[model samples]
Target: MSEKEIYQRVEEWLSRMTLEQKIGQMIQTERMSITPEEVKVFHIGSVLSGGGSSPGENKPADWVKMNDAFWAASVEEDEKHLPIPILYGVDAIHGHNNVLGATIFPHNIGLGCANDPELVKKIAQSTAREILATGVEWTFAPTLAVARNNQWGRTYESYSEDPEIVKSYAGAFVEGLQGDLKTDSVIACVKHWVGDGGTTYGIDQGDTDISEAELRKIHIPPYIPAIQAGTLTVMASFNSWKGDKLHGHKYLLTDVLKEELGFKGFIISDWDGCDYLNADFHQTVAQGVNAGIDLFMVSEKWKPFGESLNQHVNSGNVKPERIDDAVRRILYVKIKYGLFEKPRPSARYWSNHESFGGSAHREVAREAVRKSLVLLKNENDLLPLKRDARIIVAGKNANDRGHQCGGFTVAWQGVSDSMDEESDEPASKITTAYGADAGVQRGKIIGGTSIWEGIKAMSPKAELNINGNMADRSRHDVGIVVIGETPYAEGMGDIRQGDETIAEMATKIKGLMKVLHPYGHSLVLNELHPEDLEAIKNITNQRIPAVVVLLSGRTLIIEKELEESTAFVAAWLPGSEGQGVADLLFGVYDFKGKLSFSWQKKAGENFRKGDEPYNPLFAFGYGLSYSNNTEN
Candidate 1:
């Protein structure tokens, strides 16, 4: 339809929709947080799986079935006269991430390393197909934050450190999400409107203290491409620009992004972002509404927010025209997605089927996992492991499913037995993502062994040993200690703040050094942060020539360690591949992968909180190996 025709229909719908319903259209919720009864009662606009949020019967096919049930019940016989289908949402940040079997593409930071926008687009399009199968139409993805710090919990979610890279990929991802926004494409949200990844110290939802010119230069470029690509929505970040919270920044939200940037989609806020307002709940609602937030993600308490907003409209605090504006935007999106008429009927959704995590999608996921691997350091030709070598493997994360998957897996920000699956081929692990959880078994590398088990498997000649305690006998050839911050969610309650986690981790590394110092055997440490090299040497500063192996998500600050260590390996989020790591350690698989995100220079937390220029310990895509040490 023509733009005018679309506008006329949206306006007509807004005029007809009740204040409650119109406000409902502006809110979204989680299934657990709300109920079908509540869906009926509140007449909520949409629902989503925040982070790892999913239903109990969360298999991909079952997800389709369950969603259809909710849609059938919620959309049937509605006296409130709401829109047709209730848009379902998810954090399909990578390859329908929450859906167990769908292709879990590498995080955006890794994609940024690929530096290929076409790849980004293809991944998103693959994700769109899987998402559509499950009856989900809206995905909150392609978070185009120009990441300034790797310390940020969500840093891996961002596309680039440069705005240009993010813009090209963000637009590509939008195209992938909607398969061309001009058609009946899924909605796209180019988010955090101002600066999210630019926060100092990598803090989540923190502040950006740059000038207006710098902000526009560094952070605003990505949104331009996303808007031009015809993204359907924009989610305001919980961060701040200059000194004002992005949610409350009128100029950035209304004037610049909507007016100046020429973006036509509606604007959404992060989860309960409106709660950050200075006033009481009601006043907070009014302030956020006045500031130009279109969708609140108000959740179950949407009634209170909607009611307060309605009061604002009635009392002249929030212009009625603004309310109409928000509703019009919402209607425009629903129409664009064909939700206005098609309504994503329950029957079209496959409640149970063979195609959940089928072979087609798995091939893409395998490619993603492989390319995402970054080869940080390889020394003395110690990589791409040989077919046969007396190898010793050790570490807590080795062979652990929870560590392989990292955060936002099946559970919310913690550990779990998630990645135990057979390596049949490069097939999609749908049963895991989309829930064929019945067949999951203890992950085995077939004839190969885990670092601990591998040691025992190839004992005597191989002499593999793994334990938390130091080795009493120094007969072994080398020492390898795998340690770092354990899993944590949100405020990081699992990992003790300060040096407790880092200190213990460092101590454990030093202990290994002391044990193997006499032999002068090479030392390998998993999750070795670059900043710890000095401290490690200061622990003894002599003997036990070492190799630091990083085995965590995102990149790290690796400086002194780069020079001090004989070998360094960046096993980029290797899942069920501890044996694969051991293979590389024993010179089996060469360290083929290079750094995805930039590394910072040697420094102590160069976050741009005060006057710092956000100095990184290393540059992005910087990795060195003994075999292939040439820089990419």
Candidate 2:
């Protein structure tokens, strides 16, 4: 049948159903508590596995069964909605980072480093395959944030402060995901519209204090390219634009984004954002409807949103036309994805080994990890360390898989240690980073060392010392002290404040670096804070060459370090790849990555919870290297 006719069929079918049935179709729940029976009873529309949410049996084959279970229930409920399927969604930011064995490409920040639109496209395509394997057909990704301040806990989430770069990259991601969106290709959702990354104080969902013109320039470019690519969905920003809330700003939501740009897809709000109208969530349902939000990521509280919406309609606070408009847009997106004709199957059984996280994808994922590594500083050819030099690896961050994986891996924020708390709980899923399993171990191979075994199989007549305490030192040619902030998400990251709580622990690094000082040893400072510079400044000024490496998801203000350090590096979070750091430090790899976002300046006197300035210490896309490149 023609597309429009099928849409009509679904809409007609929906019209015949009860309000409970329609609401059920609009509802999407977390994979937890979701079953085929729930779908048949609730007539649910969609399902998702939020960042760390996974199934009891996480194997690829098992995932297919779980997804099929949800699909089976929804289909069996009505059997009237056309051949289209129920849309499934995932946060496939930088490949399918959430799923184990799937290729985890560079984060958007790292993608910014490559600065290649084509590379971005390929990464998205790789991400789509894994997403499809789990039986999901929608992806909430290609975050279109033109981040301004590096201090924003989510700095790593933005590709750049410059709009041009964000836009170019966004287009590439959309094309890759929807290039030929078949049953295999997942639909892309361009997100957090307008000024999400411009929050004044970098609060997660705080205000963005800026003029309209500035907002348009510094923060809105990515969406333009996203629109051109026919991205299936656009999640509204939790942050506001200028002084008005985005969730309630009719001007930007309806007038500008819809009327001006002509976005054809549905507009989904950030989680729980619809309840944030006028800063009073309890009554936001009516306000959001009047503001033009199409589909809200509402949960059990959805009935409140619906009830408030109903009240607004009764009170004439929201016109019926607006309700119809929102529902039509929602219906439009469902139809566009061919959800009406081939509605997702509801059988909890499958046989596709190719689906879900697998081997071929890991090869592609490793390339992203390698290329995204940026070498910020190199003196006396310190990097690509001498294969023969004795190397001592220190710090809690050196070899723990849990810390190495970074945040948003198998849980929100992240666990402190690698050992699974409960095997019964789903194992934390992540792209295998570092070591032999992921090629990040190239450096470890050169050094003939493995943190787990404390030495290599080859022996090489070498003693490899792994020290959690810096003071308990072993004489070495080079001391690679791995340091960095532990994992946390946006709001939690801000709460942690510089992520230097490891200070009590870092006394060990300070003590050990000093004890090893007399040996002319070079220290590899991995992902450390700039404030900690004072601790090492005296040595640095004495020209005691030290290489500082950053293993953060965001950039830090490091003017003092740049001025006094031997060298500095930005190692964007390489998931489960401690070996990547080893490879680069031991000379197995070259410093090839550039800065993804601007290096933040210390929040000065003007810094507040929601105020942002235009300038920063280091510009976006900044990186240095001792590569063999001559000026063309």
Candidate 3:
């Protein structure tokens, strides 16, 4: 639709909405909030499920029912209210990540290594299909942060440290998800609007101290292509530019993003994003609305937020023109998505489709896994072992299915079950059903294969050892150690946020580096577990030529581990398809992935770009292949 037609339709709808309804249109409540009746009375415009937030059973059908309830209520209105449909949003960053049994594709870090825009677009399309099957219509994804620092907790969310690669991906992913915005397509929301990946010391939501010129050069280009690709919504970042919170930065959010860049879509606040504006609620609401945030993602405080916004507008703190603009942008997105014409999510034709985690989606995810593996070392070609060779696969990650998918799987922080005694399953054949409760088991990995499962399938004689304590190490011709990061997301992944100094942070990380690191629903953000080093040291001490497979979201401090290993492979958080890792390991597929971020030799080192490169352990785009060719 043209700008005039969109505004005309918006103005026609605006003519019927009261101040209370307008305020309600600005509020986005969570799923666990008040009942559907409350949604009808309040005229809530949107609903979202934060990480791990799901309906009873966390199944696709249940998701459809839950979303349908809210959507039904929003459209049920009297003559006093406007019967606008509500938009259901999710963090379907890597597939419909919130839904159980959904196909979990490799995270963006792995996709960055793949470096294929067409593949990224296909992944987004598959993700949208799964999300639509569960009745969701909007996703906060294609995070366009040009990560300049790897220590940032959300590094995996970014595609690359290079702005050009990010620029390449932003539009492809948006177009993939939005897919002509007609059928089985969801609203593509390009996120964390500006400079979230450039924080100092890789702090999460910290300040970016770069100049406006650098910001325009490095951080702003991705959004331009994404916007041009017809993204319907953009999320405001939690991070600040020059110490100013992006949620309240009118110059960037309004002048740069909307006016200067010509982004016609709406700007939505992050979860409680305006809370950082000020202590006073009304003032913060005014700042956010005036700063061009169209939707307020208020989780628990929607009622109060709506009241405050209404009061601010009534008091003239927020101008009517700003309110009209915000509402126009929001209504335009809803209209553009055809939400008004379609019924609830459960009523859509694609809802409850059989392709949520069907073979086709899983195949795509498996292909992504194969393309995401980066071989860091291959001393004397230790990999591609004969199918019948004797091998010992050790390390906590070797047999752990939950660890393979990493964070943002079934739960917010993905399942982190260790290979302990309690998890031992009978040596039964792999099961097809990884029910809602299925996770890592002793002899059988659930939901997906582990590196050990892959190796054993390729070489059935291989022994699966988790602790590396097998009595006869000399029995094995070659040992493969699968070890790396435990699952993490957001604040829990931040490496240097709270510590006063680098030494203090390193000391803290070292203290938690042992077994059973504190696990929580949210607050824990431990760095790469140190047990990989201990396991490698143990394996190499026995003179076992070790080939280490590092399963992590980002490159870590692995110089010590590198010293003892005969070969190394950077198997980034390959989600739900362990056989792909096995395929590359056993020469079923060549190592085609490259390093998206410069591999750091030290924990405190900064991220390296190709230009003005630093002395990284490995440069950006570096990777090894079985053909003995190193690509950079």
Give the alpha-carbon lDDT of every model: 0.58, 0.57, 0.79
Candidate that scores best on TM-score: 3
lDDT of 1 at 315: 89
Candidate 1 lDDT, 1-632, residue by residue in tens: 77888888887777677777777777786666776666656667777776645665456666776677667655666665553457788777666656554544555666665577776777777777777767777888778888776555666567667677787887788888887543335677777787877754444555576788888888889888888888898889877665477777789899998899887778988777777655478877887888898888865577677678878878899887888888788778877766755544345533343544555555554445444455555566445443344333334444454454455544445233422224322211122221123343232112212333333333444432223133323333343444333333332311122433333333322111001001111112223332344333432243433444555555544554456555565544443324444544554334445454556453344332223464544445565544556666
Each candidate structure's count of clashing pairs: 39, 34, 5
lDDT measured at residue 182 in model 1 versus the true structure, 0 to 100: 30
Better of 2 and 3 by lDDT: 3
Question: Which candidate achieves the best lDDT against the true structure?
Answer: 3
| Candidate 2 lDDT by residue in tens digits, 1-632 | 46577468556765665544554554556665456675566556667766556665454555666776766666663454322245666666766655555544545676677677877787788777777666667888888887665545666677766677788888888988887655656788988887878765455565677888877767766688788888878888777655467888889888988989988777877666665554455457766767777776664465455556556677787776665666566667777666555544322221344644455554454455566777665666666555565544443444444454456554545444432223312222232211011111111111111222222221232332223222222334444444455665555454223323223223321111100101011111222443345433433443345555556666654556555545556667665434445555555556566665555455342221223654645544556655642111
Better of 2 and 3 by TM-score: 3
Off by over 4 Å in 3: 1-4, 418-446, 471-473, 501-528, 610-613
Q: Which parts of model 2 are misplaced by more than 4 Å?
A: 1-20, 33-35, 77-85, 278-282, 307-317, 340-352, 417-475, 495-547, 558-567, 577-583, 586-589, 600-621, 628-632
lDDT score of model 2? 0.57
List the lowest-lDDT window of 10 residues for candidate 2: 512-521
Residue 566, candidate 1: Cα error in Å is 4.4
- Estimate candidate 1's alpha-carbon lDDT, on a 0 to 1 scale: 0.58
| Candidate 1 lowest-lDDT run of ten | 512-521
